[model samples]
Target: MKDLTYRLPQRRELTTALPGPKSRELSARREAAVTAAVSPGLPGWVVDADGGVLLDADGNSFIDFASGIAVTSVGASNAKVAEAVAEAASHFTHTSFMVSPYESYVAVAEKLNEITPGDHAKKSVLLNSGAEAVENAVKIARSYTGKNAVLVFDNSYHGRTNLTMAMTAKNKPYKTGFGPLASEVYRAPMSYPLRDGLSGAEAAARSIRAIEQQVGAENLACLVIEPIQGEGGFIEPAAGFLPALSQWCTENNVVFVADEIQAGLCRTGSWFACDQEGVVPDLVTTAKGIAGGMPLSAVTGRSEIMDAPVVGGLGGTYGGNPVACAAAIAAISEMEEHDLAARALEIEAIIREVFEPLNGQDTVAEIRGRGAMVALELVDAEGHPNAALTAKVAAECKAQGILLLTCGMDGNVIRLLPPLVISEELLRDGLNVLVKSINANS
Candidate 1:
């Protein structure tokens, strides 16, 4: 694999307007051919991507502030990642790690064990997506404790599967009309300090009280939570809430599972966001940013908990494809070599500096996040969330050659997840575009 130096390729425009004629033609065709639910976030269609720029089918160059929804931590079209992927593709594609094991698969698992938090004897199992890892974590927990109930927090997004849909909190896009969800899934309130106006301890106490009174701690198998809620608007738990919950879970038999699918892999300036709290969870599920954009997920946990499941219970045909595993190995090496954790902190600093003036503005309700996983919530003078303003700002940013995304239950927050490997100049350029867009829209 080639070495990935800090390089920013020059940006050029070959077309006068975005979606120039060709992209618009193709997009129209796609609108007619593809399902309505399959929607692209950005307005234009992408034909090619390299460095920090995405070339739309119309020949426009747009800076990618959204790194494939935080999946491509190493930047798009990274030479090292591409070369590693090509080499693995040439050797073999799929051997099914379960039926026939391979070195790359085991190597990825070993790397996950070493990198994820907790000093206890750790084990890992690979899967295809974050939801699968989360589902398997619950399965392992149930098998280990012989309990039927699983606990999750409000505004959390686990996955799209039936069980995960039940675990998720939002309804419009994820759960609407998808009734009769998996049973034994319980929901609890999370620590949203900004809106709830509760300290971490207070929020934790409320959640615990609800769980103890309703779910019965003795029947619970696991308490799954995102160290920092991703799809829910980058809300970080109150400082003491996670530690207190960890202690409670320890006292009780419930396993503490950290769903770091979006916040892990140095995206939040740490290998695992849970590490920030100094509390070790029983299991950690990681996927996004794990393989430099490859489709790979893992469930790492204490050996005893992982081993509780019987043989033949936890294997998937395409769980650990060789190419994805190889990419994982390369991605992990790149993260360490570049000190992306520190770079994430640098990205956070830039965002804070850019959005500092907006803090006192009436339209800007809150600016919160850790490391590069940052967000800005929009509101009216009365502090009511303004999803329309958030949408308008994002659309303006996209038009100005910057791609951004909005999240949260109300769609009132603009979330930024630039690749950890992005250059300081490019990162600031994107943020400048965002600032200009916000100012113009506001």
Candidate 2:
């Protein structure tokens, strides 16, 4: 297969209005053909993307702060990842791992086992998406422990699959009308330091108390948590919170699963966010940044637990696609070679330098997150969520050829998921646009 020849200039430029004529035409076609429920964070159609810039159909270049929702940490079109994918494709696309397993799948598994937290013997099951990994993790936990209760936190977004949708906390978009949802999933409170005003220990105690009273360890299968909650806002739990929960799980024989689908893979200035606290979970679900934008996810865990599932029970037809495996190997290598974890720290410094000062202002309630995965929460005069202002500011950024993404249950968060490989100049430029957009809108 021939590749598209496009070299992106490392800057943001817009010659036409927000969406050019071609993009408008394409949007019209998309409207007719695509499902109505499929929503886009950014309206324009991107023709080419490299590093941190997205080249849209209208000749407008955007500084991409949203790295395909944190999928392209190595960058939108990483040289090493692309080359690996191409080489793998040249060999053969798929002989299905469940049918005729290849070496790439095993290689990727070995790497995940090595890089992820804990030096203990670990095994991994590769899959197509984060949700699939989550489901499989739950299944493994249930199978090993012979329990059914699965606990999650508020503001968590697991996925759209039936089981994941039920695990998710949001009601309007993700869970509404999607009922007949899966059973045995429960929601617990999270450590929202801004809203709850509780210390990490206090938050942990509250959550644990509730779990003890409501679900209890005897019947609970697993507790799935994000080291840094993503869709619910990049709320980093209090310092002692994770350790406390982990200890409780250990004492109770309940599986502690870290759902690092959004915060893992050096995106949070560490190989895994759980490493920040030195908290090792029994099972970890990972995806977004794993394959440099290729659809790949893995449920990596202790060998004893992963081996609990029956031989035929765990395999899937598309579970460990060779091409995606190749991309993952290259992506992980790029992260290691470039020290993207340190780069993420640098990016955090730059972002905090700018947003930290605005905290006292009425419009900017708080800044949360670490590394390239950061966010700003907007508030109104009464300190309530200002979703309108958030929309206005994000729209202004889009108009100026800067791609941004908004999240949070209230729809009042402006998040930055810039690729770790983004140049300092382009990142700063995007931040400048963000500051200008905020100031203008505020």
Candidates in order: C-alpha RMSD to true structure: 2.1, 3.0
- Candidate 2 lDDT trough over 10 residues, lowest sum: 1-10
Per-residue C-alpha lDDT of model 1 across residues 1-442, encoded as one tens digit per residue: 1223634463534465665787778889988999999888766778777656777867687778788988888877777888899999999898898888899988998998998898899999999999999999999999999999999998899999999999999998999999999999999999998889998899999999999999999999999999999999889888899999999999999999999999999999999899898989999999989998899999999999999999989979999899999888998888898888888898899889978778788888889888889999898768888999999998878777888889999899999998787767667788887877777777
TM-score of 1: 0.97
lDDT of residue 175 for candidate 1: 90
**lDDT per residue (tens digit) for residues 1-442 in model 2:** 1112235788889888767899889889988999979877665788889988888888888889989999999888888899999999999999989888899999999998998899999999999999999999999999999999999998998998999999988887888987899998888899999999999999999999999888989989999999998888888888899999999999998999999999999999999999999999999999999999999999999999999988888978888899999999999998998889988999999888866557687899888898989999999989999999999999988988888888899999999999888887888888988887788777
- Model 2: how large is the Cα RMSD against the reference? 3.0
- CA lDDT, candidate 2, residue 187: 83
Q: CA shift at 178, candidate 1, in angstroms?
A: 1.5
Model 2 scores a C-alpha lDDT of: 0.90
Collision pairs in model 1: none
Residue 88 Cα positional deviation in candidate 1, in Å, after optimal superposition: 1.1
After best superposition, candidate 2 residue 276: deviation in angstroms?
0.5
lDDT of candidate 2 at residue 318, scale 0 to 100: 81
